[model samples]
Target: MPATAIDIGTYAVKVISADPGKQPNIIRTVETLNPHGIAMPIDDLQIEQVGELVNNIVFDNKIPHADIRLSLPESIVSSKVISIPPLTDAELASAINWQAEQHIPIPKEDLSLQYKVLYRPEKSKQEQMRVLLIGTRKSLVDRFINMFIAMGIEPTLLETHVLSLLRSLDIGADEPPTMVLNIGATNMDVVVIFKGEIQFVFTHSGAGALLTKTLQQTLGLDLQQAEQYKRTYGLDPNQFEGRVRNALIPVINTLTNEIQKAQRYFASQFPQNTLSRIVITGGTSQLPGLVEYLSESLGTEILFSAPFASATGEIPQENQQTYSVCLGLLMRELA
Candidate 1:
């Protein structure tokens, strides 16, 4: 079977279709500006706009529509991890709503809740199962469904960008604990993966837009020039005589501080392990000197994401980071 995935971001929307395998053949890829400003938890009024956008993208590129998976931004969803005594499949199906009520702030009636059994203690009677609970407004889900219908497309799955980001990486079991950072236009997610399994996610606000604004303010450059300088110089000390790096440091410190706290807490929880490397992705993360700066700040190895390395296809160099989530979604069926 082939897989087609769509990733909608604040500034753009990307679609990809590929054959199913470890290194599947990439059929086609399309990316377009989201000129209509459609949001994640879209309103009823915006459904038509989203539909129009999807209609144009799919039609513009001869994308094979199979297992159409869509990724929703994490900001519109509420998630929590809870522990409960292990239960049978039937028991879990019946108990999930109740568990959701205790962990999620949304009203049960208005929420569309989903859960995944993250861990189960096989031999220990005293240990409880850990479940990942994800919740979002029912209205939001309905709107996305309606939008797809209007475009004559039946979506096979609705998911978050975090899972897709994880899917894009090729984490090794023997590798040291690693952090995956996704810094997008409006938000950021720092996920810690230990021994090829996701341990937790640390989300933060103020990402690329914030950094660009900081450059604009301190450098007295227009928004366009500021963004250009941000990409060209980033936090690299040697570039631009270190001015751009200096201006951006204070702003980046806020995120580095939060990530460092998460690192400390994870260490406390798993005393034997350390977060050694960070896999940086997303358009903002591709900044000229970000990987080096983050590695220095956290005292960890940093690697930029190369999502298509294992996939048999050629993609634009700049689009590599931007398309990570969609590539991961495609992997759900392909790999």
Candidate 2:
């Protein structure tokens, strides 16, 4: 069955549909954003505005009874890396639920959790397997369902942002272990993938908004001006200084610290595994000198995401970068 893709985040929701054919067909690709003005105060009016914007995109595009593959934002999802004895499908499912009950804080009834087995090297015993499990609050899940239903769509599949981003990279089933970082408005999520299996996932409290606030307070600029400055200066010592640089220091330090911790943990656990690359994604990833900074700090090869890494269709080159997750969702759903 073909898949429609919908990625709903705090800042925006993107929808794309692909049809089944010899060559991948793009049925529709549309996106709508929550106005930047409403980022600080998410109120009834802002919610209504977002609903209207979503409605307009669907109506204008004439997406009829679409079947969507949805992605949850990192802010609202819980995930972990766990090693379990390999088992049959039924046993794996049961084990995952039991594990979630033990590890996830929410009551079993209030959360929806699922897991996928990770790829392992051929030399390892088949029974020693790694898995990625994710849990989302039922309340949050229902809200997204309601919003999409109101727009005349029903999701056939639902997953987290990390999965979608990995799909965008087309990391092969046997590829080396790698890490991906998504820098969004509200938070930064670091995901570790070893030999195509997600080994760990963690989120940082501050992200793009933190930097924006730093600029606003230190430079006495408004949100828009601060955001512009961040994109312009972005860890570059020469371009920004004084309080501006000082304010950014905390967030940058925190970001690097998390990466170091993740790397160390992966190393200690999987002594033979090597982290060959790092991929950066999301809006804040456009920061002027972030790639260089992260590489220098982490001492690894850093790759900026080109969202359309493995899909077909001629999107304008400019939009191709950020829409990678949305496109990946479409490809996964329809392929």
Candidate 3:
């Protein structure tokens, strides 16, 4: 049976069903907005609402209660890269568990941990392997798992949004260093990838919602009007005599400043590897002139995420960006 991949975000819940293959057939896609707007996962009411949304989508689409893959929001997952001496699988597991105590701030008993070996030296004297460690509170994971269980959906895999984003891009092992800027409704995730491995992931509060709020406050317009203006004239100095652009400049600058800092830090760490290009994804990435603005400001080539290039589908263009995480979760299952 084909698996269902679900991406639960602050503003919306996206679900996609696809068969396993080189080019999975996107059987169905469903999205539903959260009526309560943005709420932290700690809120039981928000969780209940999300569960209802998922239940409605599954029922409306007549989707079977099959194995489901979920994307954990970046805001709740703590990720880090740790270096340790090469060891046997058994030894590595023990060592990682011990190391987790030091790296993860939460008590080890309260957090569920997972790690992936990212890089290992072929013929080096260092004798160490770089591993990516991810830790999340058990309560958080259990809440989602229990919710799905109650709905008769089996939760098989749960991964960070950054990792799922990486899989969606189909990046090659030999590809150069690239940065992925995922601008969503409530938050922005900045991910740095090199040689098909994630080097860094950062999340910020500056995103589409912030831009809309800025516009609403500055122009004294309603939420809907502000959103329309942002999408229609975003960052284009020539539009609305630059009023919209001027209003959004402060928020844009805050996001860009963080991006620039991340780039500098990455450059410092990897002096030999220059960022080859940047790929922008998520809902906010489609704002008018965003590509041009980021490309010029970061001084790097900019591209948009195109997961559908390999998959055969008839999804709408406007929904493509929002489905990236969902598609990526399916890709992970296929792999």
Candidate 4:
């Protein structure tokens, strides 16, 4: 049996088994419900339901005592990829602390910092490691830590949604710099990778909800109808396509601009880097014609990321393509 990591996402609670070489079996996954019949936003859920959902998933799955890999919301954590001369683990830890102070707006004393070393190839004395340093308010970190402790589980690795999403992309050793985009309920996390390492990541609010709101406003449709239209007609301008393209232009423009900015900065730093492909994941990534629209707009080949690349013949092929992040959490141990 593999160790388990439970990801408490904004939209749902996902319990993933950390099997490394095997698929991260979905021990349990459930969307929290509001008793009042009004679907409360993730942030507005009562505190008890958060714990209840987690506990129920763990119990229902008969999962106990696995190394948990929980995700901190993008708003709670700060992420930056910094390059530094290769050093001993001790030196890296100290350097990351100083680097965190420079990049993170919060005072160092108020936050807990962690770093993941991305690329430090063996060979040269001048080789540097591209490190992803994450900083979160001490209080917030404590709350999550305590939440697991209260449930009798201790997380071995606590990461942000961006890290988990990037982990899901299955970047191969021979692959070139690629862009990974994850569109969630209310936020989108974009990470730029080169040579199987992350160079930059940015999180943006307004993902599916924005599209739904646009449809609701422009077409005078309810939320469910708008969502259905978005899934069916995304960015298409045909008669059945509705006005989604016009409504989503602003949001897509903003997303494209952010990607452009990251690409520009990445190019200036690594002039020789070649971008190979763009990977899109998450629920909204399933939007019809969205990939083609992005390809035309961004001028790059687009691919939908399937997170089960590392797993063997465990999960059925059909469901493997979806649940990339939940599966990636389980595969992190393998990586």
Candidate 5:
């Protein structure tokens, strides 16, 4: 049975259901924006509203009430790649718990931990396995699970957005090391993948919302008008005699600086791997000239995310980037 994949973002909720077999036709894609002035689901009222919206989508679309695969914002999850001495399955379980204590700041009792061995030497006698550790606050997990349960849906899998994005893109082992920048409304998620494995994941507060705020404060436009201007003249100095561009340049510079820092850090850790390309996603990534600007600033080939490359669907061109996370979650469920 096909599973429903939902990405509940700060500004919008995107849901996609697809038949994973036979070219993966997308059954439906539902996107609903939050009400004015409500940025994220920070309170019970907003959460309840989101649940209702999802329930309506399921009912209207006749979506099966089965196990749903969900993707959480990167802000709620902490992921790291660590090395450990190769051990048997039983020993690995114990070792991961011990290692989690040192790496995860939350108390073990308050966190839900998951791990996967990304690489293990086949013939080396003194090789260590690289393991990916994901830790989430148990309460947050439970809340989302319960929310789904309330709507008669089972939460089968919950993954961070970065992993889902990587899976959706289906970066191949033959491809060079690549970086993905997901600029959401409230935060930005940066991920580095090499040889089909995730090397780094980081989330920060500088993203679309910052740019919106800057425009609103500088131009005295309302939230809606500021957002319109952002999409219309983002980083394009030719617009409004460069007034909008000027308002946005500071934030863009800061974002690029952070990306450079991340690139440098990754290079320091893995000198053998050179980043070949950068893929930008999220709703904000659609801003005019963002691709060209980022390419010029980072001095790397920059591309927009196209998550539907392997899936045959009638998705709108404007919505492809916004639905990258949702499509990735569907891909994960199908896999």
Candidate 6:
């Protein structure tokens, strides 16, 4: 069977259809500007409108709607790793629900929780295991479900943006601890992965739209021209006589500050493991000079993620970075 994945990012709606088996073949990919509403919706009417846009994109692309997969951005969900005292499998099951109450902000009833035991501590005095807790608002889940129902289709899988973005990478388990920064339109999600385990997930409001808006205000340019200048001369010192770069520097600095905080937190948690690489993905990640800016700011190797890095054949690279979550969703079934 073939599966289709959709990620409704604020700036674009990204789609990927693949044939599912041992090796999923890339069938088609679609990217469309989210004309319904550029800003992500919080209310029902807006969600409904976006849902229609999603449906129309799929239908317009002539992609298969069955075996559908979806990804929700970091803004709407909570991901936390909690430590628990040693207990039996059955006991741990009971413990996580209680742990969710303590760690996740969503109420017990409104929360939909998922967990995985990452790894147990060494032969130490206070022996305990760490668990990854992923919780989403039930109403949010309901919103996605109802939105799909309006299209007469049900999604087979749903995941957070960070998880799906990580899945799209070719990161190796033997590799050193790495930081993945998803600079999406609405939110910036920083994830620390060590030995294939999630060490930390942090979501921040410092993101692409902020940079664009900063340029808009500082350069006294309209929204479209500001965005154009941003994409053209992003942090490129020589491009705009340092005027555009000057306006964007503060915003980029603030975002890098959050990344540095993640680095410190990762170092504190895993004293032995140092973050060696930083992977930048999402639409805005490709802004000119942005990668160089991050590399210089963080003093680490920075890599841009392409959607089909692991897949062979005629896979186009246009919009590759922004389609991370959607491609990873297809792989959730295909790979």
Tell me the spans in candidate 2 whose CA falls farther than 4 Å from its real position. Answer: 1-4, 20-31, 36-49, 61-65, 119-127, 240-246
- Give me candidate 4's TM-score against the actual structure: 0.83
lDDT of 6 by residue, 100-132 (tens): 999999999899998878877765557878888
Per-residue CA lDDT of candidate 1, range 1-335, in tens?
A: 77788888766788888874556568777778777645573666567677777887887786767578899888888877788998877999999998998888898779998888877778657798778888988888888877887777788887888887887786877888988889887788888877666777757888888998999999899977998898888888888899999999998898888888888988997998778778889878888777777888888888888888878865655668888888887777532
CA-only RMSD, every prediction: 2.3, 3.5, 1.9, 3.8, 2.1, 2.1
lDDT of each: 0.81, 0.72, 0.82, 0.69, 0.82, 0.82
Worst 10 residues of 1 by lDDT: 36-45
Candidate 6 wrongly placed segments (more than 4 Å): 21-23, 38-40, 121-126
- Candidate 4, 12-50: lDDT as tens digits: 454556455444544443334223321122332434556
Q: After superposition, how far is residue 310 of candidate 3 from its true place, in Å?
A: 1.4
Native-referenced Cα lDDT, model 2? 0.72
Summarize candidate 2's per-residue lDDT along 248-270 as a digit string, tens digits: 87788888898889899889988
Error of 2 at 267 (Å): 1.2
lDDT of 5 by residue, 101-124 (tens): 888877888989989888877765
Off by over 4 Å in 1: 36-38
Could you tell which candidate, 1 or 5, scores higher by lDDT? 5
Name the candidate, 2 or 5, with the larger TM-score value.
5
Worst 10 residues of 5 by lDDT: 34-43
TM-score, candidate number 5: 0.93
Off by over 4 Å in 4: 17-45, 60-67, 120-129, 239-241, 312-322
